[model samples]
Target: MIEKKSITFLYRTYKKHWPLLLLALFGSILESASMAGLAYLIKDVVDDVFVEKSYEKLIVITSVLIGIAVGKQVGFFLKNYLYPVVIYRALREMRAKIYNRILRAKPSVYRKETSGDIISRATTDVERFGEISSTIGTNIITETFTVIGIIGVLLYRDWKMFMIFAFTVPVLAFALQYFGEKRKKYSKRLQESFSQYIQHLNQIVSGIEVVKLFHEKVFFRYFNRINSDLFKRQKKNRFYETVYLSSVEIVAYIATAGIIFYGGIRIIKGEITAGDFFSFLGGVLILVNSLQTLQRGAINLKALTPVVERIKYVLNLPVEDDKGKDFKGLKESIRYKNVTVKIGESVLLKNINLKIKKGEKLGIVGATGSGKSTLVKILPALITEYTGEVLIDNVELRGYSVFSLREKVGMVSQEVFIFNDTLRNNLLIAKPDATDEELIQALKKAKADFVFRLENGLDTVLGEKGSRLSGGERQRISIARIFLKNPDIIIFDEATSALDVETEEYIMEEIGKYFKDKTALIITHRLKLLEITDRIVVMENGKIIEEGTKEELIKKKGVFYRFSVISSS
Candidate 1:
């Protein structure tokens, strides 16, 4: 993680929000100056007016003090009211930057990373960024100005008396300086440990069924011990914060005592008036204490470094951008030749060659983990770094553009992902510009028009991942989505396997109509799907084991015959 000044990042991110920020700084300075000015008027009223028996001077000084008090109230409202709104604006801006990063990320990026952690990084990371994003700027402005303005007044009252306030600031400053690194270090550790705990919490929730079936009740006990250890470590961190704040209070009291004792002697010797001596002491008390308050908040900010770092680490990560050529008017077939995939020391695929015509149905089949899905993922330009010559017409896959290929391709996977939104919107996801008439036609073609019979019709909100819908209904919607897009090519990866035999047959009939004159590719483990595909390609261990028409492959009595035998069993 890189070390950036939180204050600088906060300001640069939201300079436009500074109108409120300016108001806060102005109000704080005026309020601090008013207090010191009121103290000056008190000394004059007691000594020059009452003690010297001058009533006229008393009225004027008293009026000025009253005006300062009223002015301070107005300043306080304008200043205090501005901060939270400014903080809100800053938070939104930073959240937008994180959101934009996610939008620009390639789908492959998520495959290479953990989405659960990435989601936390976007939300919790932005929140952690918020910890520093909102506060440090305003604190630097108001606190610095307030402390400085108050101290200036104390010096003007009596430079010699100002020495008492100065001596103690260094003591508090030393405490803050002494504990700064320790506080930051502990805070960093606590944040990292908490993130790890959060990761574990997600893993357990996702695997609750497995845990239940296995009857691992004692697993929680082990997890509890780990969490308990983390809790103890966090408690230890707060101890450092306690020491930092406690030290500030100690310095403040010592300074308060030093001022009174020294000033009391000055009054007795006639070196300063009794009223002047008392007012000077009061000024010293406020100024010294304000400095202490500033240090305390800074220590708290230092305590947040770990969380801020975690957030910054993610937001600063490189977001992938689709810089591929625009394919608004593409007129070419896709070709794959000699594609190879190797991970570490393991070779997943070797020297695979194939061709996909612009409008032809191509079926890819293989055993589980045979790289069937991996091969399909490459067409969308998902997997970029592989040794191969994939061409859009004659243009190399790497030379042409990702956006160009994506524009004409649509895929429906075995594990369907549906957002919690209207049924209409789910279909419109394929083509946001599609109209109600167009949507219904696609739905009818995919045999999903039964959605209109529901209570909400197109407005029906399918729960997350379409958990509210039955397996067949979800697949129909998935098919309707691709039908709505009417892309040049479609890849169906076991899209109907979960359905009953009759439902799967009905779906197959519906899909054949949808793909009648278009290019369609189906990867199916069920032999039922093979009857629909014009050609069959059997894949074993990532290479094409055999390929022919359904009758041709069965007649060969090889891998396809063995596959049929296994299916019957």
Candidate 2:
């Protein structure tokens, strides 16, 4: 049995297609009614034609049978066609909503979920949820009506035989409930195992090079463990499903045998004609088949309980907070006062105080995991949960709408992500309405003039993740986006680290010229990149240990001086 909450969710998902649902129901009713008509007419054919050998009556009965067949075909066509239309349309809407929610969900949610687990919910779990609709359409509507019509015929032919068949209902119902619960338990385990299988596969694909270099045996062992688990869970799930169906079939067979035995006794006593007994048998067979289908549908619904819960989890994830005043342009300064950030027990950033005036270039350098990236990320509202305060133009950072605030900041990170599209299309993500000439100009500014040499120029299809482009070329493409955005503040989070020395020098020269009058924050380990900054902050273990102009820090012979000496050597 489906839980009450699952029923409510499915109703809300499918209620918009009620017109098609009603039409499908009408077709189901017609189809079942046609079956009953055929069974009822079986008596006429057996008695009038087979027994009486009346040619006229035989012709009339044949005509009526032909009409029933035609009606049944029409109903079959309507139910088959309309039910899919309703189901698939609802599924399409559900996929879109899931994607939208994932895109807008908070960063914390991403941390909590693996990409593989999320993908499993969106794809596999959703497809399984569709079984609920199938059960409703096929088992609930069609089979239920078919059982009722056939039972009506059975009662009319011989109420005593119908009574015999009725004795099996309580036993069948109990079996269905018991087996359905067992199937549901295995189904949940099967889905979880599948999720882990997907996650393991994703890890292997993403780290194929690492596996090839050092840990091939280790990764393979992990894969084998996950795969074996998945196989075992799937085997168990199938076993339970088969057992449930077999139990239902056994009960149906017993009921059929009981009816046959009682009907034979009645016919011998002359209580019913041969034609009447056979007609009742035909109705009983149809009813048994319908009940089996209804039981299968119920079991499928029970299996869908876990799938429904998984989908609901994704849809209910918290969306990013976007409610605040729209940020214009920064006029004065960006300041951090006693700011701290933590995730679980890990302190990513501690109480830090820093300030930079508009149009001033600031440099931040720290060892790995010293909170360099985390500090810069706070400016774009990507990490919003922090104590103390971040002020932009003397207003609280949260006071500005996250979207509007992001529009004013341009960040070029070391890990450049290039979509598998033409260079022109990839560049247009920064400024969607930019013209061809504007794109060419931005590429030139970022020293990414290689696009002009490609066979199709901007129309070239970059393979997945820009496979056709070299590291420097990909970095140039990212820089081109920043040039296109032309925001008030520019952030270089080791953005040129992937480029060759010559390419890095050239790109930095171009960037220096473009950002001369703009407020800028440069986060890099390379000491040379600090040449353009008016001031520098040195961080160690989530704290700002030193702050001064480049020359002043070098004069102090502190952490910055040590870093400078190491770079120079």
Candidate 3:
């Protein structure tokens, strides 16, 4: 069943290379025919050249052997040419498709999968698929046809000898049945072990600082455990492969011995000519070698099931739905009607009714895990699987395409993610066609003018996660993106949280002016940030418990008052 599945996958992935396939087919046929010709020529060499002792026949036989050699070489060249072409092209296409799927897939997919596993699937697993192409392409096609041609030659020489050789087929089949399953099982385990190994590596690299600061014993123990498990699985996999090879060798030697004994008896009795015996020997050698190759290929194809299944899992993930009415701009207001967000048994956002008019500056302040960020996330339709409706201009958020809605709404969060690329490229992600002058102006507005001091200016390449920039500088770059986009609605989720007091005050004062005309929602734990907003909502335990003007809330001495008092102190 796995063999059939592997074959089906190969056919589907590579069917477009039909022209190359045709050439490969033609070449394989020629190769097979040439192989048979070589066997037949052995008979002529013995009978006509040696026994007859004729110089004329000897020259003719020599010429014919040379011709067969040339044909076989030509066939070998053409037949093998397409294997790499099909393998590389098919894998390139597969990688491109998988990468596209990764980009378009919903955020939830990322939550359930590890970064290491995803990377391994895209790189290592795709490579395994490429191996399947080579294994099935060259081994199955050429070897099978060559075996068939040799069998024809053997039957022509002597049917009795051919029958003796054919008996080994069932024995080889039994060997494959038992050994193939074991190889498949071990191969799957090996791949999973590799994933875990990669995940451990990723965790250590991403958190290298934390690992360095903390006691080193815990990390070393964890790594040792993972490495040991990987080594054990790898050892088991190699053991099974050795077992498969050993079984194949035993079967091959026994088959060869039986054929030799039978053929020798017939030759001694003068039942068959020396020429006939030699030709049959040639044919049987080809057949046995082909059988060994076929066995190896079958084992490899079986092992590929785990890789194909892993790739299929990622490709089958539900991509984000982009088919909906186009969104132009926010006209009047955004409304949240009893919206609730849940994941498994945990509720992140409770039923809430709220509205923000066009050009309104709304502030949300709450302790951690109070759903402040979750509440704003719903307005942009990032968290789509909610209980009730989030409407913009009275149109349901789901009614608008994700791309168009996100295009009109921009968000800058506390955790700024900068690409390991140039400052210009990072800024261009917000507005691809923005000119240098426009970029500078936006950078100025966001108080990110530090770019001008760099030797390369906008061309300066940032390190991973913008490690080249300070925390305040990275936050400023993120703010620059928001300013460049100039979306109809802007949401800042503690964009100034990590900055020192001076930098935070500067960023807040600068970015505040940019939000004046746009409908904005700001989430911050710092109560001082709310002074710039017209209205503020205080949340606790996924529900909005207090809402009013900042002054009004302070006068009420409620949750907002308590938050303000705690933050100031």
- lDDT scores of the candidates, listed in order: 0.74, 0.87, 0.86
Q: Model 2 compared with the native: what TM-score?
A: 0.91
Give the per-residue lDDT of model 1 (tens digit) for 1-569. 22466545655766887777788767777776776676666678778887897888878887897899997887676666676667777778767877877776766567667887778877866676565544554454556766676666667767887875677677768877787667767877888788778777887887887877875668777688769868987997898878767766777678778877888888888887877776776776666556655665666566355666566666666665566666553355677789887755666777788777766677777889888877787777777656888777777876656776777777888777789998878878899999999988877876775688889888989877787888778888888888777777778888877677876787678778766766778898888777777787888887888888878888999988888779867
lDDT per residue for candidate 3 within 1-569, as digits (tens), equals 47566567767888998898788777788888899899978998998878889999999888888899999988888888877787798888998999998988887677678987888788978888888768777787889898888888999999998898788879977886688678778978998888888888898888898889999898889889888888999999999988987887788778888878988899899988889988988887787778778877877776687888888887777799888989998889999999898876889889988989999999998889999888998767777768898889999998999999899999999889899999999999999999999899989877787889999999999988798889888988999999899899999999888777776777778777766788999999887788789999889899989999999999999988987988899
Each candidate: how many clashes? 2, 0, 0
- After superposition, which runs of candidate 3 have C-alpha atoms over 4 Å from their true positions? 2-11, 111-121, 176-202, 221-243, 303-310
- lDDT at 238, model 2: 97
TM-score of each prediction: 0.85, 0.91, 0.90
Better of 2 and 3 by TM-score: 2
Q: What C-alpha lDDT, on a 0 to 100 scale, does residue 15 get in candidate 2?
A: 96
Q: Which scores greater on TM-score, model 1 or model 3? A: 3
The candidate maximizing TM-score is: 2
- Ten-residue segment with the worst summed lDDT in candidate 3? 1-10
Assess the local accuracy of residue 545 in candidate 1 as a C-alpha lDDT between 0 and 100.
Answer: 80
